[model samples]
Target: MKLAIVVGHNARSQGAVRPDTGETEFAWNSRLAKMIEEEARLFPRIRVKTFFREYCGSYRREIAEVYDQVDAWGADASNELHFNSHSSRTATGTEVLSSGSDASLRYARALQERMGAALGLKDRGVKVRRSGRGSESLMSGRAPAVLIEPFFGSSPEGQAATDEEHEQRALARSILQATQDAFL
Candidate 1:
């Protein structure tokens, strides 16, 4: 199977910030992307392609760039990695946003449930995002696609998790397991 991993934001337009560690969501997700690709590559018959904005152009510049890459890379499924943020520091959990397609919905649920469990986070449930967060996911892939927010970056728990040794590896494993369950 072919998979495309998208790191959520560019350097200039970084996403959420972890309160305790002062870590940017973009930096965390870039690390997760690298770890995910490294681990996923060990699986048999799996081909991986990536859209790391740090290495390429920003998705916000032209959302169509991600859509174009879906066809260009011929991915079987794709995932966009992100960390959510909110005004409330106490708010913490996991969310999976789909394109409202049945396929994507299924994929989103698998990912959301697994990551929420793995991270010991509250399950925020899977929902349709017509625009904004998961829009590029919908426009891009021919197969199932999802945007995963595994934790609240602004929350203390979220910040603490990122500080753990090999937190990126653990999250990457969560992503890979979910992807295998959904697409493999």
Candidate 2:
């Protein structure tokens, strides 16, 4: 199976109300992409591809290219990665979303479980998403795609705890483990 990973916005993209200081969406994306790539090296059956490593303009345009690139590469599955945030400080934990298709839902549930186990975070459970401004069209086609907000990265506790290298690696490991369990 081939997998395509998409990092969030540009390093300078307009962030939400609460953004991570000194950490751009691009930076977080690059880190997550690298982590996933490293783990893919361990699994021989699956190949991984990264979409939109660099940012120009027009997020919609870039996302379209990502979809085309993955489609042309014949990826069996595509995952769009991003961190979550809320206006309220109380919100926490990880979330996985599927297209409500059996396969996608299965992947979402398994991934959510693995991530929760590895991260020791609360389970926000899996949900099906339909429409959105930022949704990827790559998923709109033949490939199975889902958007993952692994944690509320902007949360006060999350930001404080996740700034360290060890914590980041741990989070990455959880994501990688979830990928292995879900796909392999």
Candidate 3:
């Protein structure tokens, strides 16, 4: 399978930040995406490519460019890495957003299950969103895509759960396993 792993947000507009550590979603997920790509090397059948959204001054155009690039690369499946955030620090869980297609739904479920287990977070289940914050990334590409929110960066507990190197490695493995199960 040809997999496109996109790091959520960009350098100019990094997504939610962990207050305590000041770790931005873009930075954290960039590292995770690289780890995922490295892990994919172990699977001979899987070809993984990592992407970062360019801050082109327009969010809509940037997303379109990303989808265009992914489509051009002829990816079979795509996953965008992100972490959830809320004003209430108590909110925490692992969830995946799908494009509402059957393939996307299956992919989302696989990711949600694996990531939840890897992170040891509450399973918020798969959410089908045809429109919203992450909808474009899920629906705009030719390949089936899912947006992963593996934990809430805003919550101390959530941060603690995924703050270690081992946790990140486990999450990377889970992502590849999910891709294999859902798409291969």
Candidate 4:
């Protein structure tokens, strides 16, 4: 199996901001992409590809760019990495989304469960939605795809807490484990 890992946002803009740490979604996702790509090598059955390491214009454009690249790269499955944000800084957790397709949903659910458990965050569950403007064709058919928002970028304390090495490694393992289970 081949996997495409897209780091959300670009160099120009951070998807969201956490008031406390000044951390951006772009930075978080970039780090996670590196870890995930490295960890994925442990599963010999799979090959990994990365996308959107740089910014274009807006997040939607970044998503589009990732999709086109991954699609052309001929991926079996593609996952976009992101951290969530909310009006209430206290709102924090993990969320996985599918394009509402049966195959996509199955993978999304499994990934959500594994990552959520690994994260020990409030399980906000898997959500299924049709692709939209900002979504950048998550459901669009460039191999099976899902968007992973593993934590709230808006929460200062929560973001800071997971910024540790243990948490980052756990997150990468969770992603690789879920992909292994879902694909291999």
Candidate 5:
């Protein structure tokens, strides 16, 4: 099976926070997204690719590139990386969003459960993002694509944990496990 892993946004973007400092969300998200794709390379039958917009481009540019790659290789699934942020320090959980397919929902659920289990966090549950705010994901043309938010920054729960590498690893492992459970 073919897979595309997309890092949500540029780590250096304005409002981005460093996980180690309890500020930046992309610090953990981007690294973990890369880790997931790298680990997927271990499976012989899975052809994995990664997409990101960190350097000299925009999300539009990066996703366009992803679309080209997906078209070229006929990717079967896509994973978009993101982190949850909230005003209250009480919110702490993981969630996944799909375009609207049973397979997509199942994949999201497995991802939510696995990541929640790995991080000992609350399972925020999976849902279809059909409204306006998530339009980027809805129109990405990457069918069966899901966006995962595993941690909530600015939350008291988020400030409690500081091991960026360990957090990233846990999330990446869940991503790999989800892919294996579904595609492999």
Candidate 6:
């Protein structure tokens, strides 16, 4: 299986920031993507590649460009990484967004289960998105794709649970397990 691991957002437009550490989603996931790629080495059958959005002039165009590249590379599946954020600072959980296709749903479910368990967060379940910020990322690719929201960075509890080297490694392992379950 060939997996495209897309780090959400860009350097110029890092998604959400963890208030306590000032870590941006782009920066965190950029590191996580590399970790996931490194973990993939254990799964000899799985080939993983990381992609970053080029902060093009427009968000829509940047997503299109990245998806185009993933398509060109002929990935078997793709996953965009992200974490949630809310003003309330209380929201917490792991959820995955899919395009509602059968294959995408499978991927979402697999990811949701693994990440929720690995992070010890509430399982928000798999959500189907036909339109919205993540819909394009999930649907534009030739292969099945899903966007992962593994915890709310704004939530102190959530951030505390995930912002650690061991937790991050667990998250990477969970992602690899999910990919194997859904595609391998």
Candidate that scores best on lDDT? 6
**lDDT (Cα, 0-100) at 138 in candidate 3:** 87
lDDT of 5 by residue, 3-75 (tens): 7776666655734453436545555655666777667666667767776655455656655665565556677
Residue 80 of model 6, lDDT score: 97
Q: For residues 74-174, what per-residue lDDT tens digits would candidate 4 score against the true structure? A: 99988888888899988988888888777778778888998887877888888877745335547544688888988887776467657788888888888
Cα displacement (Å) at residue 101, model 6? 0.6
Error of 5 at 184 (Å): 2.5
Checking candidate 3 for backbone clashes, the offending pairs are none
After TM-score superposition, the amount by which residue 85's alpha carbon in candidate 3 deviates from its true location, in angstroms, is 0.8
The segments of candidate 3 whose C-alpha lies over 4 angstroms from its true place after superposition are none
| Residue-level lDDT tens digits of model 2 in 145-182 | 77777677668765765666676666666665666667
- Computed on alpha carbons, the lDDT of every model, listed in order, comes to 0.77, 0.70, 0.91, 0.79, 0.68, 0.92
Candidate 5: lDDT of 86? 68
Which candidate model has the greater lDDT, 4 or 6? 6
lDDT value, candidate 2, whole model: 0.70
Model 3, span 1-184: residue lDDT tens: 8999989999999999988789999999999988988888777788999888999988889998998899999999999899999999999999999998889998889998888889888989999988878988988899999999999999988998889989999999999999888987
Q: Flag clash pairs in model 2.
A: none
Q: How would the candidate models be sorted by lDDT, starting from the highest?
A: 6, 3, 4, 1, 2, 5
lDDT (10s digit) by residue, model 6, range 1-184: 8999999999999989999899999999999999998898888899999999998798889999999999999999999999999999879899999999999999999999999889999888999999977998987889999999999999988988888899998999999999999987
- Residue-level lDDT of model 1, residues 10-78, one tens digit each, is 778777788677778788788788888788766666677778554355555444676567668888888
What ranges in model 6 sit over 4 Å off?
none
What TM-score would each prediction reach against the true structure? Answer: 0.89, 0.83, 0.97, 0.89, 0.81, 0.98
> Candidate 3's C-alpha lDDT?
0.91
**Location of the lowest summed lDDT over 10 successive residues in candidate 5:** 14-23
Q: What is the clash count of model 1?
A: 0
